[model samples]
Target chain A: METRVDGRLVRGDQTRRAVLGKAVEIASVDGLEGLSIGRLAKELEISKSGLFAHFGSKEELQLATVRAARRIYVTAVVEPALATAPGFSRVWALSECWLDYSQRRVFPGGCFFAKASHEYGARRGPVRDYLAEVNREWVQLVEQTIGEAISLGELEADPAQLAFELNAYYDSANLASLLHDDDGAIYAQARHSIRARLESAATAGTALPWRSGRSR
Target chain B: METRVDGRLVRGDQTRRAVLGKAVEIASVDGLEGLSIGRLAKELEISKSGLFAHFGSKEELQLATVRAARRIYVTAVVEPALATAPGFSRVWALSECWLDYSQRRVFPGGCFFAKASHEYGARRGPVRDYLAEVNREWVQLVEQTIGEAISLGELEADPAQLAFELNAYYDSANLASLLHDDDGAIYAQARHSIRARLESAATAGTALPWRSGRSR
Candidate 1:
């Protein structure tokens, strides 16, 4: 009896994961407001009642989709950057990974947060609050990474200011690429800006990450 | 008969202008997809058939809204910048105008293009095409303004690259301000980055725009 219950729970988890996998892709293309439980159920071949049992409200589903996108973001952009040595190289890695994440269409439509944040930015709600929290978290991470380079004497700048600039490049490239149906030129432009900004801040005699023979 | 017909024509024009004004506001906040003829008619107290006659279709309305937004953008951001001398100060004016446009909430939600572009970016349609065209137009304007500064020998940088970086800062600040509901700190950060970048590119003898006591 215990085994049967455990099996049911695992299956339920699988279904929920699969549903959110589809949900994030849709939300990336369409806004989170475009997410409809009926449509999701129809697309996923799940009964509407089953979806309701999983997510009691549209807000809940939207929140879950955001959470799912966040996990994918961390894996695709954050984890690899963190794997690098904590200094100028790691900062470069973060930029490279982010460009790849957007260019490669990891979220199908583009960066999930870019789309979702603009969608819900003006509206006041749980979704907006959550997205704001996520953005704050991201900015802090970038600032922290830059601080590592500053502390190591490899770079010199205000971490918060530099982080804001780096993030701007990432988002601009993502939007330009998506809007223009670009063929990689936008990402190249973004890379140029990121490298130049980092170079401007790197201390003299410090080995630049992009210029060095080291792979980032 | 001529007088009556002219009066009717003038009234029709007035109604169309009013409808588009409201439409742009709605699109800025809720996105173009959220603009519904029924809702507009109900809110504006016009007959649905009247709106249908004016717009003909949802696509037409969205396209018209975009056009209207472009006009407002030119007035709010472009014209003011163009009024400045065509040099480093013009480029600086452009940045200041754009930041003001977003900061002052000219569209009540934010820069209409920033929000609308992200909304329709991934989707393929006439709306997306129109948005892409507008974005291209805006980028070219920035590039042209930067070229003027470079030609005047007041700045030294790649026009396209500098345009991309400056525009990135404008958009990033707009998004950050909206998401965080900031108290003007985001704009200050963007201003610092913009000034620093331009200062790096400015020729030694060129007078800095922001630093001068000129009323900008």
Candidate 2:
């Protein structure tokens, strides 16, 4: 009985991972509400009940999908920036990583949070609450990075205000890139805006984090 | 039969308006995709076929919903702003109107364009194309308003650049307001940022657009 139980648990975990992997992709484009269980099962070639057993309910499945997307988001946007040491360099690194994440199609649709945030921005319940929490966490991470730079005397700016502005540019570029598919130049323009804003706030005696001649 | 024909036509137009009005509210919250005809008909207490007859397909329904939302958007955000003369005041007015539109929940959710833009941002179809056109029209309107200020020698800034920054603050505040419901102060903060940016760009000789000592 123990051997049989172990085998079943392994199979369940495998199915759960597979379901979530596909769920993130679908949600990235069509949104969480759009990622119906029937569609997920059909696409993954699994029994609807099999998928249902993994999450037990549609709400649970949505939550699991969000968790999956969060993992992917961290890997794509946060981890790379974290790999760089904390300070202005990490802050700048995060912006580059984010722009690249959206441009390179990390989820084959663009930034997961941008899509999810818009999808659940109006609605209430667990999904919206989760997304709102994720947003706070992300903003805090950005503010903390900016704070490191400020404490190092490399820049003189309010961390939260600058974080809000930089995040604005990043999201604006993401939406603009999607709106104008033919224009790959919006990303460069966003990068330009970010660089200029940071440079304007950099301390006079501090070294620039980026290459001096880089055109943003 | 002629009397009956007129009655039928009148009934059809009434239903069309009803559907579209509901469509905009639903789309604003759940997105254009989430505004399903079946759900709308059920909610509106009309037969699905009767609702479907007004729009031949879901795509047509979506297109109509977008058009309906656009009209409401103009009424809520642009009309009040445009009531002011086309100069520095108008620019500030536009920002105020936009913030009010989102804060007051014109569609009982938030800015319809912000929600729909993110919804169709990655998707391709007539719906997405139309949204893109509306966005271009909107950004152009902002740019034109700024241009008017520049022409009047009230502002000395690039219309496109100023438009982008102003638009960014508008959206950032909208999203922040939604995510942080308890923090009503975000709107005032957004206004502060907008005023500051505008002041920085305003020509030295121009009258300040906001009230004196309003720069908090």
Candidate 3:
């Protein structure tokens, strides 16, 4: 027997998606705390109570926005890197994709985690806790990717330390680009740092993934 | 003739200093936008009107807070570095003092600029403009210090690029430390990166400032 669709569930899911999309955009500019049901409803031309009904409270809305941002982040940064085979190529792809994601304004305000993490980092609440969790998850992903390259004998370095330095370059470039409004040079600097670190870590006889003429 | 002493003027100045100190502290955690006259008055046990009289408005209050934070920043980071003589010593000292300032929780939240810059980065306002100015002033200072080393023939590197990389490491470590409470390893990692960069930049005949085991 065929099952019938629940129209209410389908409508709620559609509304939830729409609300979250706007939530991430607003949070990108104003911050998660600055995001409000009234403002979001006014912008979306929906009733305040309707938006509140979906989120239940401001904190819930912020949490849902964080989740939505994570999905976008994975699609923009992680999925592209995953398409490359696991090794040095994947690591370089991840860095390039991340810089491109920020430079291309995937979120229209730089990296969502960079903005939101700095926003809630020092404050205490479910929002701050959730952000901290996301940060840990991202760093772990970087470290694991480095570990894969090292295990494959393509690179030889402390995965954790290399991951930390690479990530530092990524975020530093992102903030500098936003702060200075000079995007052209910042990404080039980041790419230089990433290539230098990887070159130092690459094992003997292994091809440098970022060399000028090398094919990945 | 001596100028007439006004108790009200003295009281107002004292109150203004007190208010600004607390404002920077709160803004470090919440943000300049999160700072409100009502909240400041309630927390400081002063009348809202009295605080308003001193600042005149929220915009004025934010401006004053930024100035106050700058003063604290200079004291914590610049003064200590300036105590050392110009050259690689001063440049290294500046980096050490900066890392210590963040690690010691000088602002009780983290680096004040890191928080404030990210907060107003994507938005347009006096606050964002002020932060942008501060960032330029800071980068210029780093470049100037490096230029001193270059002039003395103690180092060989592009000042602008070196400053960018060093500043990147500083901020990356700050964010990582805040995000990972259990990770005391970030500070060490940042120091390693700094030392490596400095070593690579140091002229062959020059002495290494960090080689004396002065301990960063």
Candidate 4:
């Protein structure tokens, strides 16, 4: 699946990559609708016609930017958690990775989806539709992660409800951190909330992943 | 406090009110930064410089829009909740009003603060600072509301934590409803979550307000 692409575009996937890299960061802070090719070209010190050749329209640029952000999001947030064992530990790792991603300013504007989703969540258009789709996929991933824990008998709760709560904590902390100019304590508060919620939901005899090596 | 303003500028104040009314709706969806004097004047069928004279600058326009939004927020969300007796009932009322506000489309873009706060949350500037201040005021209001519950012996959770969780549910439901296009079911889910959280945190023998009219 990785190798499937047009060979003609390969030599200068570099231009597309650079354009998208800047696009994602700007979109993360300003929004897809705010991305102007003229502004981007000015920032990149490139020809407007050259950039125009790649993305025929502003909408295309926004769409491509969203795709680029998804790739970055997967690498920063999903893969690390996937590397952990599936179940409670994986869920825990997923939460930590997400907090770290936002706390570390992976996108200069905090979580790309958090900013973009809120930006596009209200309007009706292709941009908004793509963001909504991405959000659905992300929520499904969280629910599936929780489902793994529930199926393993380590946790017992409604997957959708737990997913919603945990996602809320993740987003709330992100906004709080951003509001406070990168205050790290908000993430700790989220971690505390996540830990408490997990502890309450864990089965009576299930080993706690967070409390490992604390004394069995 | 209401009558302390300049009586000589009442007619000018009316024009300002009219501009801000439309401005809040536009800013709710497009964003505060997206609010331009020319577009606003064109939409209102007035001269750009006339509107410019009222606001003086783009930043001032954004600030006025935020203030206007805060007024609408208070009326739609806070006033109804405050009307109810303070404590768990009021807390529950606040939740209900917020869900109703979002689910009913009180603003064209759903909750204005949710959209605008995320829009400016990352950047450093006066707009961001004012939005942060508004967020602080809001969170403080939630905490103070929860404090009433705790002091009354109706609930016993940490006020800040409880506030964070409830506010999370409210804002989460708002964003979800927006993404889902005015889906009332999401608001119901939020109500369920809020009810359960409050029920869990309530002191023993505290009446569940949500169940007051329903038969056991």
Best by TM-score: 1
Question: Which tens-of-lDDT digit does each residue in A1-216 have in candidate 3?
Answer: 999989999998998999999999999988988888889999888899988999888888889999999999999999999999998989999999999999998887889999998988787788888888888888899899989998899998877778878888898899888888874798998888788778878888777766666655
Off by over 4 Å in 1: A1-5, A214-216, B1-5, B213-216
Residue A192's lDDT within candidate 3 is 85
- Please provide TM-scores computed only on chain A for all of the candidate models, following their numbering: 0.95, 0.93, 0.95, 0.93
- For candidate 1, give the lDDT: 0.94
| Candidate of highest lDDT | 1
**Pairs with steric clashes in candidate 4:** none
**Interface DockQ per candidate:** 0.87, 0.67, 0.74, 0.72
Instruction: DockQ for candidate 2, please give it.
Output: 0.67
DockQ score, prediction 4:
0.72
Candidate 1 clash pair list: none
Estimate the TM-score of every prediction.
0.96, 0.92, 0.95, 0.94
- Across A1-216, the per-residue lDDT of candidate 4 in tens digits comes to 577878778845888899999999888888777788988888989899999899888888999999999999999999999999988888889999999999988998888988888888878889889888888899999999999989998889888888888888899999998888755878888898888888889898777777766644
Report the CAPRI category for model 1: high
User: On residues B1-216, what C-alpha lDDT tens digit does candidate 2 reach at each position?
Assistant: 354358878888998999999899888888888888889999999999989988899999999999988998889888999999988889999999998888888887788888888888888889999999999999999999999998998888878777877888888888888877846687887788788778878887766767674544
- Candidate 3 deviant stretches above 4 angstroms: A1-3, A212-216, B1-5, B213-216
The C-alpha RMSD of each candidate to the native structure, in angstroms, is: 2.7, 3.5, 2.3, 2.8
**CAPRI-style grade of the A/B interface in model 4:** medium
